[model samples]
Target: MMRGGSNVSDAQLQQILSDVPRIINDPKTADVLVKRAEELGQKLVTERLRMAQARDIFDELRQIESIWLREPERALRRLHLLRPKLAYRRARVRELGPLAEVLERAVAEVVSAGDAAQRHDRFRRLMEFMEAIVAYHKFYGGGD
Candidate 1:
């Protein structure tokens, strides 16, 4: 049973699974499916972050920063993956000027730090950058 009181029976679930090949064969439907999957992934990440304690968030952010420090290109690619969701959230919360400013600055710092040669400095900047993101989500509910 799902939150809306709709129960997905096994037969329906099996039917959907049986249609997988057809779904993949149709380009338009496949594209829609992929987009929906991405949105779901973003929602899951947001919910996890929202439910996490500050210490847990900090630890995860540090791990991400460490990855960035060690392999900047990979980190940049990972950050790029997050761009769409971050942009959406920013647009939704544009009225929060100060928070938006901080987020913008942090994003810029992260991008710039990717090119920086000093690992220690880059790590610190990356931590600050992620902290800003965490702060935004904490203060304001993650945007729809």
Candidate 2:
């Protein structure tokens, strides 16, 4: 049975149980920024899917690169905080784990690899992962 006060009505509260680190590390104020982050994350996901369907690797990479490069630390920080939380839920962890790895790899490759095409491919894949991460943040209303 659900207990009063112990129950959080928002679906995001369920996500918060896992995303403790994200809650701790979020720069956005708990009141104002978290909701905004969540919305932004959710919105980017549809954009990513549309780009993927169109086979628009260049466009996807361009968008992701802008976000990642402009805020590498923030991206990294978000991932760092999210990975462990997601890992706790085996099924969801399985679904999202590879994406996390892909994003991490893409960041590394983009930062280190000199080959233009390879970097572009990595960045494109990274977009998929970023979208998912953003979706997660969206689900949480930012930090949860």
Highest lDDT, which number? 1
Predicted candidate 2 versus true structure: per-residue lDDT over 1-144, tens digit per residue: 111112232344334333322322333324322443343344333223232322232244444467665675554454344434434432443433333332333345444435545444444444543454454433433331
Q: What 10-residue stretch in candidate 1 is worst by lDDT?
A: 1-10
The C-alpha stretches of model 2 lying farther than 4 A from their native spots are 1-106
Model 1 C-alpha lDDT per residue in residues 25-144, reported as the tens digit of each score: 333454433332233223333444332433343564466566875787676665554445455655654433223333343444445443355433544543543454454444334433
* Global lDDT scores for all candidate models: 0.42, 0.39
Return the TM-score for each candidate structure. 0.36, 0.28
